[model samples]
Target: MAKHCTIIQGGMGVGVSNWKLAQTVSKAGQLGVVSGTALDQILARRLQDGDQGGHMRRALEAFPFPVMAERILKTYFVSGGKPAGTPYKTIPLLAKDNPRELAELCIASNFAEVFLAREGHCNAVGINYLEKIQAALLPCIYGAMLAGVEYILMGAGIPLKIPGVLDLFAEHRRAEYGMHVVGALEGDNTTMHFNPADFTECKLGSLTRPKFLAIVSSNTLATTMVKKASGRVDGLIIEMRTAGGHNAPPRGKLQLTDAGEPIYGERDDIDIAKLRELGIPFWLAGGYGHPEKLREALSLGATGVQVGTAFEFASESGLREDYKRDLLQKVISGTAHVFTDPLASPTGFPFKVAQLEGTYSEPELYAARPRICNLGFLREAYRTSEGDIGYRCPAEPTTVYASKGGNAEDVVGRKCICNGLLANVGFPQVLNGQRVELGIVTAGDDLVSIAQFLPPGQSYYSALDVIAALEKGCSVLST
Candidate 1:
């Protein structure tokens, strides 16, 4: 049996669960998960910022694909960072068939992240990816495996084929993923392909296939994964709607409470008894950051608990200092509020947003920002009238989305999540050498209680503090 971690740090945002935070937690003897979302952009932006502390460079030096690494460095690594008022260089958006440049960036970036996170530690480190980012999945997973990642966890969509992709990559074989294109004619080709041999400079024999964990919210989905996945699903993470980032919509009809939040009925609740019968290790997420909640999860047959909101505010997280300071202050003042914004995410999934005045959570702030889709991480794939796959994001300009056959109504409250997430990590894109993108912070409903992680006299806390606090309940239960 594979070893299971009692505390799996939830992979929060674009760069929130970065290598620094993951290394800190993993070195402390728990599972530290680096967010696998938008890593290509994260790597490029950090390099443009002078590759601060030479960490990215250090990791790239160890990357087996020297030529690929060199290419990325030459393309994005600015000597002392870009000019004060200049916009960061943007990479091309990924699509059904990505350019070789973008593919190489995706691979090298993911490898660098996992490599650095695993530095100075023999303990297991994991990379978490949103299964919805299908365009980048192939290259990204290949990169993580190259760095010897121990676990791969995915959420935000049903990842039934990911396990099989892992199996193929282990042997350096060709792997293809069927892209979900909306309104594709019967004969349209909607498949994305990646072959390891094509990208490898030299033969690097077989890679160890990492364990796969599918994050799901329903018992039926868990059972389906166990029984029908393309390859072995090592475990599961049952995340409740209260968790941070993009949440699975409530089961049944989309009924909302008076406050406009989705109402989760009995159908949304996980049947722990049925879950136990699946015979796979599982973790419970969403509001499971507290010691008592960890204890409760264990008693109810969970392998452990995955906590995000707590770790998100920890000192090691990659969140920008100003934003972190503002949010932490709110938490301390007992005024931190997280709203489940059903219309914010381009994916149409309900996204949790921390209510901060100056951020995109405010009506005025969100309206003031110009709509752009340069990053394209959250764009949807659709069949164009010309019989080719095209991409569209509702958060883009209203006319742009409508021209691509999208409903203008879908663009009503949609925010540029890709840009907002990048901004959260202090890499907001500047347009026309002016207008800076503002960030939209996402956290679990438990954001109100992160203040508990702060010591009595201190206003800040570390990832270790959060881990130790959650483990306290388990230790006491054992006693």
Candidate 2:
């Protein structure tokens, strides 16, 4: 925990920020982050694909718990990958009462990801999780901790209790997180619990409590994190609407622009002055990928910039080669269109989507993909009138969502983000008749500038190129 990293590679979801990207970034003297979101599924899918390059197998072999790793590999590893177009084995959804196998996969998969990322590098590796995915939080954290993950970065929701959970797990104690059931009555139980001892594979000692960085868009939330968090607030990641993935809703009343994106006015600003007054390190996200912008943020008292869009297109990133190639070409031609879709994500947060013709961003493609919720990561839990806890996602079939107490209006324009994200990293699902997964790309407003990383006559770039551009200043780069 010697704080020297000035750049943090954002942990893109559904396997986008895989070990390759994080390891490359960390090797270059920066913080490399692996997305902890749905890593169990990612590992399973990778194992199903024959554990290519033996990277997954290597990590699993090093996993402290050999038996657990063996079980996972035995269940999912395919000899030469399932015959051509067969569908991947389905995984159960995480809930207040999760299946033991699902929990074990969560722990093993997270460990494997972090272990691989930290391989051959002493530089700190971090794991990113959305607090909105509450049910699987405890075990994931413990699993990452098992691999000595240095940082736990969480956002997409207020995560006041996570720091405390980190504290508990590091002490080898049990931790409980109350799942936010939308309509739970007073005194009804909705807690998710995890005890480290139950899952330990060998004799173990207390773990190191990783530094916790809570992503926030406002000074209010930053201050609240330090003042009200369950334990130590290591730092803050101040992101803006222009960043990729889900964005914080505009402050106060929600308003939409003519383009159907959130209308972020003055009130939505993070108030850098107030943030400075908080007396802790904070990284500026959004359009801060350029050298000049990074310099400006440091001048304004930021530790560094949490950059996503730039690193996201790097050769090491998990983004499919074709998707990266197409998007980068559009960037070079100045034809890339990024839409901040308000209804695409089931979590009700505005999701930034890069409009690509061949992907789900296209009208016909979106319309043709049958609505399904097999992943269920963004499913919302609510209390039924009959005193039972129920889960529903707006992205699920309109009829099914409505039957579970979800409103019809909530389902409009909602895409299957879970499936679409997996597709972005080349792990898309395959159904009958050769139907394939489609990509739904998300990027920041800085998508156009990613081309700057390219060397003369080259159409692609690497993670080092991005770090170099930011550190040396873009003005130094020759066209």
Candidate 3:
């Protein structure tokens, strides 16, 4: 067994970096992470799809509360899967006032994902969540802790309160997170709370607090997390704007090129020397997927490099085969196109989008889809005029968003990413009984270089191919 490793497999969301992919990397002595975002939707859809080979049921059997597991199985599992062209049954969206059943689904679904990823190996496994998705944070962390998740890495916002939540959950104590509200005044009591005792009657022991790594973009954010986090700060992952999914906006006035991507300047550069002085282990993400880039990161005082694009196309990754084949062919043909869409994400963070013909990146497909917000994870809470909390998503209908205090300008270019990402992994919702959801694939700028992992004639690659390529001649790679 290796004491220290050099790769932190990127935790791509909505089932892209799933159990099969995580298990492969962890078993090889690296930090394999499953996307903890949207597991509630992933779990229910898996059950409705017949769980295809009983994988979900097998993991649920290991859940500490068999009663809870049985309840979830009974409610969502379909024997032969739903009829084609029929939509998945929607569960209630998560909110501070989530129904007891809805909250349980979040917990059980998160637990099942981590439990399944941790099986068939003794190595450590981690789960990744966005700090912005606060409604389900408490129960989701508790569920992951129940499966002994070894690390919790978060980004997409300042996660100053996460380490403390981990501390409380380890002791089986109740935990609360102050939900971010847009128009709340001082003394506002907007918060979401959870307790393990509410779910299980079995006696429990204190769980080990997993290491916390705050994913950040600048030295300032890194220093802020180190000096201001609620509990111990374990490490950091410095991801640049080139990484897939949501990227931290560049500092200062938001300027864009004539082509429309956000311009990154010297202010965007993180001072490596200053960061190394913090004496905390860090990893470099965004375009650092090559062998030389990996070596360069290690030489710069990093623990390793977090690679997403390479592993995202691996055999074990959860991306549908058609999308993989389509993208890989583009990579090989030198025509793979990725655009950094500044306004597509409702979080106000720039989202990386891979341009594909039928995906949501297409103007036609993006325009044709109705503006409906079924999944509300990205919706923000605001204080209404009556001092009551109200929720709205910029991606939702324009009239509805305006009625809830959202500016009409914010609605432009916004897409329903929650549903779009799930569709990328083969569980796209069937809408209107006549149309199937279109996928919106996200990859790092290194999407073109993924061709290196494949053979000269081969079209696809496996997880080991990427690990071997990055670890070639590097002593940190396991033999």
Candidate 4:
């Protein structure tokens, strides 16, 4: 079960793979994921910023569903910390009929971040997500399988019903999920249910399915996720186009490179022997984070390597330590750059971008911030010429996304990336004069090879020192 570890840390999302960088890469055995995306609005803004070192009250006192962690700590804690310029309150919009305390704070904030990154680790602990955030996939996979999460992953899209929603929480039932919606029509009502007995109040302990993977980038999306997944995917993370946050774009029409970014030639080459004839287990994300690119992705066959700009500049990543000390001093002075940007992600994919100055990839700091969509997690539920189902955001306010049908030139320069990736992890959104904004950080293009996961002079390193220098070899493939 130790899956030949080379490293799989790459789950950097809104809170940049928190829970102390997935418990220091699952206590060094390697695979530590945990970025269940907007983890219930980053666990309700870390319990309205008061649950500080109590660490979401110690992962909601190890939630095994204790009344959904006492009803999400009696509705998002907030006992002390909300004053400093006042903002953490917004938890409402997640429709398709959500409520019941936002589905128990999306299953106790994805079961307290996969129960504190599988606490004191027994090793295996994965949880990523972002199949275009389909209405928080069944209370975030029933809160990361009620904290036992042993690998789910998922990509930016084409997550063909997430292995039947992990076989309906390993059979404790009620899963539903279909909501992509955009135009709606053939009898409408786009699905979206979830009933592990309507949020488990008692007899429910079943969940053990996990193992899904699917973060593909080609070889035809890894042979269409092993011939159209709906139940058992269990592999593939391919990811290239120099991976970091979101990337897979360039195949035909879109070209860019004069530093605008995208342009991936050789027809975006990815055939690795047709992905080794699609026989399950795979891994190998862009610029494959170190150690001779994890032995050149295990001599071209690969079942290892998923790093994210070297565990997103490690020191237990949830980023923002002055943006990891100014991007690790521009990656130890080689001057960090990163840009895959294709209009910086409103799920328009192609998004690496990190030439940071005041952030938002600096076009004068993204034209001095302003466009404000108040964190509607990549909104796009469409269909409202009166037929209802609203939610817009192509980074919002191009006249409220052209009054909801969107397409004012498809939202120019997009960038809301959920409140700038929760203001690149120091939880931004403060508005109305006290300022704040500044986020734009995304990673890969080997961001100056993360100074080879720093150590020579030790600038800072952790996710178990970048998975122990990529399991003891190092130079991640000369960028």
Model 3 deviation from the true structure expressed as Cα RMSD, one decimal place: 1.8
lDDT of 2: 0.90
Worst 10 residues of 1 by lDDT: 251-260
TM match of model 4 to true structure: 0.33
Candidate 1 TM-score, C-alpha based: 0.99
Error of 1 at 397 (Å): 1.0
Could you give candidate 2's per-residue lDDT for residues 1-479 as a string of tens digits? 44747899999997889988999999999899999999989999999988789888998898898988889888999977877677899999978888889999999889999999999979999999999999888888888999999999999889999999999988889999999998898889988889888878678888888999999988888999989999999899999989988898887788888888889899888889999898889999999999988888888888889999999999999999999999999998999989999889888888999988789888789889888888899999999888878889998889999999899999999999899999899788886648898989999888988899998999889999999889874334322
User: What TM-scores do the predictions have?
Assistant: 0.99, 0.97, 0.97, 0.33
Quality of model 3 by C-alpha lDDT: 0.89
Local accuracy of candidate 1 as per-residue lDDT tens digits, 24-137: 999999999999899999999999999889999999999999999999999999999998779988789989899999999989989999999999989988999998899999
Candidate 4's error at 33, in angstroms?
A: 17
**lDDT (C-alpha, whole model) for all candidates:** 0.92, 0.90, 0.89, 0.79
Q: Per-residue lDDT of 1-479 in model 3, one digit per residue for the tens?
A: 12445899989997999989998998887889999999988999999998998988988888888888888899899989988788998989888778877887888877888888888888888899998999988989999998899889998889999999999999999988999898899998888889889997499888978888899998988999999999988889999888999888888899999989999998889899999999888999999888889888988889889989899999899999999999998988999989999999888889999998889999889899999888888999999999989899999999999999899999999988888899999999887887788899999899988999996678889888888888862655333
lDDT of 4 by residue, 1-479 (tens): 43545578878897788878887777877788878888888888878888878888888787766776776777668888777877777788777768888778888888888888777758888888888878877887877787778888888788887798788778778778788878888887888888777767667657788888888787887788889787788788888877778887887798787867777788778888878887777888888777777887877878777988778778778888888888889777878888778887877878888887877788777667778787677788877877768888887779978977788987888888777788888877787848777788888788887776677877787777667777765344433
Segments of candidate 2 deviating more than 4 angstroms: 473-479
Ranking according to lDDT, highest score first: 1, 2, 3, 4
Candidate with better TM-score, 1 vs 4: 1
